[model samples]
Target: MRSFFRGVFVIFFLMTASNWASASIGCGDFLRDIASPPDTIEFVGCESEPTKQGAPLTALYRVKGKDALAAELYLDKKMGVTERMKFVCCVWEVRGETFYKDKKTGLGYHIRMGSEETIHNKREEWSKIGYFYITVVHLREPL
Candidate 1:
């Protein structure tokens, strides 16, 4: 009986391990090393957890210093019309730089792409590196 239970446990873990790999990680201060706004970026870790199932993910990156720089990115529906969102309403507008789909859920999302510059004091040496994000959203019927 003990051996049977262990086998079950192993099977369960193997089935769910892929979900863990795709799970969102707790992220923190991104681009905290930069010294100026709209300048180059040192990519830092940052991720947002969904408050509920299928909730959209949001991420932000910024550095605190003189001439500080900041940028916001989030995954959600596009500003254009969607059949799933015909009845939902919100004042906020979201637009994605590109489109993406999840392999596990097969859900499509609009993603915002941000960029950071290469860490260089010299203006000419600076170059931008891109970042991408995506999360799920399902609008509910108005109350």
Candidate 2:
């Protein structure tokens, strides 16, 4: 009887612990919470990259849509989350990242963002939630 009860207790504890771990806030939550545009649109998926310290970092949880529009929406949602975390929004002169592709075979690609822009911004604006970092970007108004 004692061994049976112990097994049951262990199972219960494991179940609850796993649920709590998976319940951590993620970029998908932000994408789902926002009001959708008039037309039907769906986001590809949420992705997380590890920071220098191996902390989960979500840079741009964006949908497949107009680049400028998606960027603007991402910035807005990120700002709201940061504010809720008691952090101020850190705007930058430029906030968008660029990707480069090799011309020969179009296989190689390079991703880069402004270092000067993200340095202060990341430190000041990034909010920590259960070892995850929400990296926000400034929405540059279309010129």
Which prediction has the highest TM-score against the true structure? 2
Which regions of candidate 2 deviate over 4 angstroms? 1-24, 27-29, 34-42, 50-54, 59-93, 96-143
Q: What is the alpha-carbon RMSD of candidate 2 to the true structure?
A: 19.6
What are the lDDT figures for the candidates, one per model? 0.26, 0.26
Cα displacement (Å) at residue 21, model 1: 19
TM-score of 2: 0.25
Span of 10 residues, lowest total lDDT, candidate 1: 83-92
TM-score per candidate: 0.23, 0.25
Query: Model 2 over residues 50-98: C-alpha lDDT tens digits?
Result: 3312223233232222232333344344332211211123222222222
Candidate 2 residue pairs that clash: none
lDDT of 1 by residue, 1-143 (tens): 22222222232222222222233323333222111214432343434434533332333433222212222311122222221101112111123233334454433333232223223333222123223111222111111
